[model samples]
Target: MAERLADWKQSLDVALFATRMNFRSHLVHPGEVVLANLGALVQAVSGAAVFMLALSTTGVVHGWTLAQWAVLTGFTTVARALWNTVFFGTLDIPDMVRSGELDHYLVRPANPLMLILFSKVDTDVWVEIVIGLGMMGVALQASGAEVGAAVLLFIPVALVGSALVFAAMHLAVTSLSFWLRYDAMLSMLVWRFDSFAQLPMSFYPKWVVAVFSTVVPFAFVGYYPCLYILGKTDSPFVWAFPLAGPLLLIPAVLLWRRGIARYSSTGS
Candidate 1:
């Protein structure tokens, strides 16, 4: 227990250091942070505007009301903010592999994957985070849903789980860099799968829903969380999706380990 506690503390310290270093690096240019937040706010607004405008005209999207869609958008924007700021570093695996920069991480005392994933931070994503939560709160109020224990407990837990699921997914896909000489396009393609979660999964056919739920599992990121909050379905199964993140991480970590075993530095 002592050893595990110590390890957790060390990891936490490393994470903090990484975040500070990343901030310092970016802050070296005084206007960079401001520009980042401005750009991110515009991006967030554009996405919400597109959906809200359409919903105003149509009243609903494939059975999802405007307010319900806002909940999903909140979940997606926050999760995407997380993915962009943190897990997105997994996409760097290809560049690290090709340049043999991965070797530096491997030789470090810390876990290589943890080091890589936590090595940078995008501070600007706070804009998206704020917008996402604002949308959720305002929409929930308009929809007459109470922001009680469930909302306080569930949304955050769901977001953490959602982030983990995609982190593992990206790690697994980018691990392909160990075999392929160039994996940029493939990684980008997999990363784009988040767009599917920007709206309700009900809009798609059953097979597409099945694929996202299991094969790729991006559905857990937005659809299920919002479903529960919106009271759209009575199915108890919605509660189980958060567990899927850690479960899916099993195979993803296995693939990553295998890729590490097979890797040979370019110098080889």
Candidate 2:
């Protein structure tokens, strides 16, 4: 048990160190960082602005209230932002494959996937987390939901689960690049697919929900979890869904392993 605990600690330390290095690497341009972050703030605020303006009409969409929609927005925003900021680096597999850059990761002593995932960080987009949380807090207050330790805990847990779910989808799609080197258009669609997820799954048709629930599990990414967060539903699936998210990682990792084995490297 002690050895296992130490192993976990070591992994955590390495991950933290890699993330810090990646963060610093992106911060080298102070002027670029400032201007980019300002643009990010405007982008985030504009998205929220559009949502509020649209909802100002019906006061609801697909039977969810403004405040509930706010929670949903927050869930989607934070989860997507988290993935974009931290884990999206894994999507660079194709570029690495083409440029021979991935050899650096393969030569490292640490896990190649870890090196790839934490290999990059976006300092400019980091503020999206704050914006998302602000949306949630304001929406929760407007809805009169109790703000306490439990809610606080659930929000972070939900955010992590949601982000992982999205990342799993991304990783699985990205792995395809190793096999389908010429299919850039298809892979590009993977990230854009999140636009469908921003709204509650209820807004979509039955088939859409079915695919999201079973295949990609985008429902668990934000929809059902948002329901639980807002006290709207008590389905055991809502609670179990997020916990089961990492299960998707099993297949994603398998794909990564196979893809790496298949990788011919630019030198070859």
Leading candidate by lDDT = 1
Native-to-model Cα distance after best TM-score fit, residue 159 in candidate 2, in Å: 1.0
lDDT of 2 by residue, 93-152 (tens): 777777788898777656778777776777866788899889988988897666667557
Q: Supply the TM-score for candidate 1.
A: 0.91
- Candidate 2 clash pair list: none
**Which lDDT tens digits does candidate 1 get at residues 1-268?**
9987887677767766876897789889969789878988998899889878878988866887888788888887887787777776788999999998989888866667777778877778899889998998888888766667866787788887787778778888898888887787888898777778876888999999999888788888888887777777657776677787778788888888898898888894
User: Whole-model lDDT for model 1 versus the true structure?
Assistant: 0.81
In candidate 2, where is summed lDDT lowest over 10 consecutive residues? 236-245
Q: Candidate 2's error at 42, in angstroms?
A: 0.5
